[model samples]
Target: MIRKNYNSLLITHILDGNFTYVKNGKHTTAHKGDTVILDCYNPHEYYTENGFESIWIHVSGSNSYELFEEIEKSNGTLIKCKDIHYVEKLLFRIYDSIKGDTPPSELRISVDIYKLFAELLNFQTTKSLGENNYEDTVQQIKEYISDHLSENLTVNELAMAAHMSASHFSRIFKQQTGFSPYDYVLIFRLNRAKFLLKNTDLSVSTVAYKTGFNSESNFIYFFTENVGISPGKFRKLKF
Candidate 1:
């Protein structure tokens, strides 16, 4: 049994066996390939029936506390890693770098730690999106969007393609792609208009229709607002 309260974060990846972790008096079981993240300031405890093999690291200073809080809010204290081998490799790299004869600077170690946290956050996001096939699903949706670039798309239509509710699809889409579906559609249409303007002899009005805008005026307004120039002026530029 181990318990403590401090201003650091502890992340442990379980490689073998099982253990029970307690946070705020709630007991959770962690098995192989599971990871336990603890904000040391939150009194917690963990113990194994027999014995378990694990790799862990303690991080503090800088934005470590803020990062931990964000991750905890998204994934809670106990997380199931998508790839335990990758997590182990990262932890081992940090360990070896520090234990070697020529130890790296603190910045190098901090960067690796940040990368580890990123991977954890990614896993959490992917898990929330769906099972392991979520990436394939999102890719398929993107392809559908591309293939229908000349049509006015709606959240209901896109959600039907994704087999999810509009609100759920919108939430996960932004989490995965950093843009809402409407914003993504708008950006895609803008890029297609730019391509037609730059690479083809299509007129501005033709480009507007081909890219799904309702009128030449709307397309010009949007293009000028986002690209900082009118489409005609944009096409006239040589470099």
Candidate 2:
């Protein structure tokens, strides 16, 4: 089949036979147990000489575009699921949900779509680590970040913990986790700050310091920019 410039995302799982997928002048062959994710906003074609069988879905709305872009950036548009059965299960759940007499809830469909994305991401992470022999390095780096949240963290320091150069570590970290090292650190700090603000009576300044920000003003600025509210305001909400 041929398609282009459509405003939705397409995910297809190849259950039988084979097909050639061409996107942006690149050709890929997908066979049984493989999945193809396409941003229909681009010109693409996929067809089989002998025909093929597959389960497919089109997804749009909410954070679908952003999530698909992130996954494609890290893992490409095609993947061979390590657990194709689980992938099929998720697809079936979505299909069944929409086919029921009572219309499915938005949350239910979103959950399944998110799970499919997670499965794709996890597969990519495992594939990257296994192929590159970074078996324990990424996990170690994440643990180090968590353990040292109360202190300043840098790409250089994180690379040292992973025993790789800054550039190389940064590349692998983004590929494996779909986020740069700096963004990862920032997100981790924000999460910790939120937790402390909500769970403890610590002052905003103390929470800021504990999460590795240099000053309360800087932390407040960062939090407000990302979370859309001040730390004190976030804490006041009944979460």
Best of the candidates, TM-score: 2
Runs off by more than 4 Å, candidate 2: 128-239
Q: Given candidate 2, what's the lDDT at residue 64?
A: 85
Model 1 lDDT, residue 239, Cα: 45
Give one digit per residue, the lDDT tens place, for model 2 in 146-203: 7788798999999998989999999989986668999988977886677678768999
Give per-residue CA lDDT, model 1, range 141-213, as digits (tens): 8778877877889989998999999999898788756789999889778766765787679989999998899
Worst 10 residues of 1 by lDDT: 126-135
lDDT for each candidate structure:
0.79, 0.83
TM-score for each candidate, following the candidate numbering: 0.52, 0.54
The lDDT, on a scale of 0 to 1, for candidate 1 is 0.79
Q: How far in Å is the alpha carbon of 120 misplaced in model 2?
A: 0.8
Q: What is the lDDT for 58 in model 2?
A: 94
TM-score of decoy 2: 0.54
